[model samples]
Target chain A: MTEKSAQRRPGGRTARNRENVLRATAEVLLHEGYEHLTVARVAAAAQVAETTVYRRWPSKAHLAADALSELARTDNPIPDTGTLEGDLRALLGQILALIERPEVRRVILTVVSLATDDDEVVAAKVAFWESRFVGAAAIVIRAVERGELAPESDPYELIEDLVAPTYFRLLVTGRPLDDRLVDRSVELALSRQGICAAPVPGRPASPSADD
Target chain B: MTEKSAQRRPGGRTARNRENVLRATAEVLLHEGYEHLTVARVAAAAQVAETTVYRRWPSKAHLAADALSELARTDNPIPDTGTLEGDLRALLGQILALIERPEVRRVILTVVSLATDDDEVVAAKVAFWESRFVGAAAIVIRAVERGELAPESDPYELIEDLVAPTYFRLLVTGRPLDDRLVDRSVELALSRQGICAAPVPGRPASPSADD
Candidate 1:
């Protein structure tokens, strides 16, 4: 087997090294800011050889991008709960929890700050958002199949409507987040599909259970 | 008369000095960023004495706060179009125009970045948003008076819904802003008030005109 394939084997030294390096990268980016982040610093913090980090991730931009993407992936997993409301609540719950962390808030604000001037960061930011939208698309697709959403509904717009208020409150307005915001967001998004949260007369109490 | 009263006179030298210093403070914050902004640098840029700037705004944070607040006030004026839809469209249009400027975007991102670490900046941000909400409260109050909305509708929530998506797209999703998004935002917020943009059959087409 090739050396690269061998290194990439599950639970191998390379896997451990990657996790350490990404964790160090995030720590440095969060505490020290982006300008202070370097491959050498990350490698030293991770207790790995500098050459190893360079060989695996050629640039600081790539390192930062991967670190953020990893954080997003691990912190938020797509929920497959039966009802769209349940799925939305679950997904938003994960997002709210993730962003509430001091480190996560710093990372998000820092990336957005850098993205204003750095092309690499801009690309990374766009890719990060695209991955999130793609992952959440399944929730929309499932709702459409279940007749909770119209077949012609755009998943991206629906998701945007659902999460924009939360992010806006957090990042722009600096307002507090509470259960009311979460419930209001879900209600607004579902309302767009003409799917009321309250049960109507003569309708199945739980549509997913009947299906 | 008190010495402070003399400085407060309209079109006086003190007024010109205040204008110059504020403009210079914004220039430094926008171009050099928050970390680089100082009373000395602003005084130099404004062609005023350092003591003059220090006397009025004692701290960099105070200067930064005033500069941002000044930017927000001059760039956007609350619209009084005599209709909720017209007012929302006008207000959002101004916001879109302002944020699309590179300098304005930098100022906004910079303040948010600094607010995370600085107590004064946090207070400043809160005050900035409060002023904006208070300014726009007139729109909602007028709409209610015209029977266009429920009397109990929360004005803050209505304004939040109207502007959150735009800020979210700009700062979080990094998406392009267009007329469609603006229209959709206005529609969604108005829909919450049960106000339809399209006229129904056998109704006064222009409700504002009828009033």
Candidate 2:
């Protein structure tokens, strides 16, 4: 339980403590929000000393950022559906589900607001987004390997295009997300890469045909 | 000067006081940020009584929302270029310029954070977005009328696709915005509506050709 020993060890009891701390952090953020989240409170909830939490995360922003990033990592797994369209649809669905939660939305908006003033939060935000993009890029890479997408296609841009609208609805316009928007977002993203999803068996080939 | 008289007068001095109050609100928000913005500060800055500001805006959140919304109104105008492509490009350019300002970004994030809990701020935010969409819809309506886009093209959807990536970069990813993103966004949006911008006289036809 010594501070020096804890810092030196990254496995066994130390690893358990880290997991417990992160879990407590998420619980505090989700239930109590960013304003109520503090190193002291998290340590108390995690059954760790204040020094332990401070030795690990320097500030409340860092703690919150890590908690949210860990939430994203664990909550949403990359889809490996056979086709790019199916995979993208599934991935978008996962994102939609995660962001739609009231607590998650509150945490996200608070993080965004904190990032405006805190450089530590900004760095954490950038790292969190970079990791998400890296994970999502697997879908595009698989599509290219299967000859379903151009090899030169930028996975980052494609992923951004696919998810931006949903996030836009969540954060910007306050518009509701729906099945139609999700389907269209997938279609538009694929079309940008010159890969169109085949029309559903009985549906019109061209969107305009419906008119 | 009397409270009753000010409420009764909608023109002349009342209008001037309204303009001055809004201008002072913008100044306080831009220079001092949302945390430092207060009715008293704004009233003192505008050379009006605090009652004047409180009579119009009941809360700090409402004052901030209205000031930011008014700023958006005066800063970005609707584009009326002859073609959808031209108009979208112009409109996006205007949007990019406005949002790129640090102060504007700060105000937007602050307002978004406030809207999570405050109903008045939420109403103002919704109204602000609706008006912007209404103004931007002119581009889509014009294009549909001129046979450049399909008759059934939804202006809101098209506009959402066109601008979501830029806002995503600003709010989520913390990525830098550039010309390539702007151009690609415009192209992707139009292509979804079955409208493609013509290649420049000497440029390649297909985007892949550039590779």
Candidate 3:
């Protein structure tokens, strides 16, 4: 529904069917959780044959991953508020909003559960995360480009460091995520680039370099 | 068999019985995953009556949670290596090692899966994590006492920030956890308190405060 998904691949009817099927897939995922999702059910909901769903996504994991990825790509916004901090805060806010959604939580929990055992699902999970970080990474990219951050700062890794804690808290520690949490995260990451005051240690001023 | 679990609770025979049953519970959890784990199977494996296992720990989640909590309490080391960085690196290394273990991974994944839908399991998971963090919290406490950090800094939250990324990588991104990752995490955290040099910001010295 966002856009470009219909134009992402070649072929007309085939692409349209996939879009419709994936939409139905999302509905089922939200309504029933991943445990009850099936190609048959998806096909029935999409008003297509079981063979059609099977021909595209061999497993439910594949279908679910595809559907979620499409939705995120087409709908998820890339915040550009000029300042890196503003952009990151907006991005984290969006993520927090998404995680608080029961349907989103179900999809995430299901994918994570599958990612534990299945190699295909693991790959999908990795790709899904890598792509999701695109918007976040752009903030870091602009900061680096404008000399707001060090030239040596790795954008992808920096985004991971900034956001990984939120995921960690959500999935493992069960801590509440808030705007303050997001701000502190961005601050900690910014500290690495000398954007804030660094606290002292029981040593000489300079830090020793390591490879 | 860490010490004190034998002496922590009630009657001598009862304590011994619970410990043995919990040990058996762990064995079943490791060998078969949680799907096949039951009080009857654990009782048979422990050479105790099924009624006894049920009498002590009503649910498998309860039993498993108790076992893991006890083990963490007794076995999880409280690192005091003079420096905050030393403690953090040592703690994160220990966590990375634990996460890499097959049995550990299985236990965590199974518990996390159950925690998704089961309220009791969610409570267990929360208790299990809070207790596991006690050791890590100690490290942060020592750092604050040693003048390495601010007095008002929350030790538990700091430890959560330090360890969350490792869990995120293990459970979600499927990225490899290594010494470099550990070192970067420690460095980033240290940067927060000005223990390391705060890199310069391009715009202003002061970060804007938010309500």
Candidate 3 versus the native: TM-score? 0.82
Scoring only the second chain, what is candidate 3's TM-score?
0.80
**Fnat (0 to 1) per candidate:** 0.40, 0.55, 0.44
Q: What are the lDDT figures for the candidates, one per model?
A: 0.78, 0.80, 0.72
Give per-model CA RMSD: 7.1, 7.1, 7.3
How much is B93 displaced in model 3, in angstroms?
0.9
Candidate 2, superposed: residue stretches over 4 Å from native: A1-11, A40-62, A195-211, B1-11, B38-63, B198-211
| Tens-place lDDT digits, model 1, residues A1-211 | 6876766564777789999999999888877778889998999999999999988776787788878778778879889999999999999989999888887787778776665566666776777788888989999899878887654456777788789889888877778899999998887766644532223234444444433
Give per-residue CA lDDT, model 2, range A1-211, as digits (tens).
6977857468987788888998999998898788888888889989999998888887777777777777888898889998999999999999889877888888888776675566877877887788788988899889977878765567788888799998888788888889987899898888776632223333344333222
Name the lDDT value of residue A4 in candidate 3.
Answer: 64
* B1-211: candidate 1 lDDT, tens digit per residue: 3547766664567788889999998888787778788788889889989998888775787788788778878889899998999998899999999988887888778776665666766676777788888888899899889988888888788888788889888887778898767766776666655565553234322211222
Q: A46-120 in candidate 3: lDDT tens per residue?
A: 889999888767678778878887777665677888887777677777778888887887777666667467776
Can you give the TM-score per candidate against the true fold?
0.80, 0.83, 0.82
Model 3 alpha-carbon miss at residue B39, Å:
2.8
lDDT for A209 (candidate 3): 40
Candidate 3 lDDT (Cα, 0 to 1): 0.72
Q: Candidate 2, clashing residue pairs?
A: none
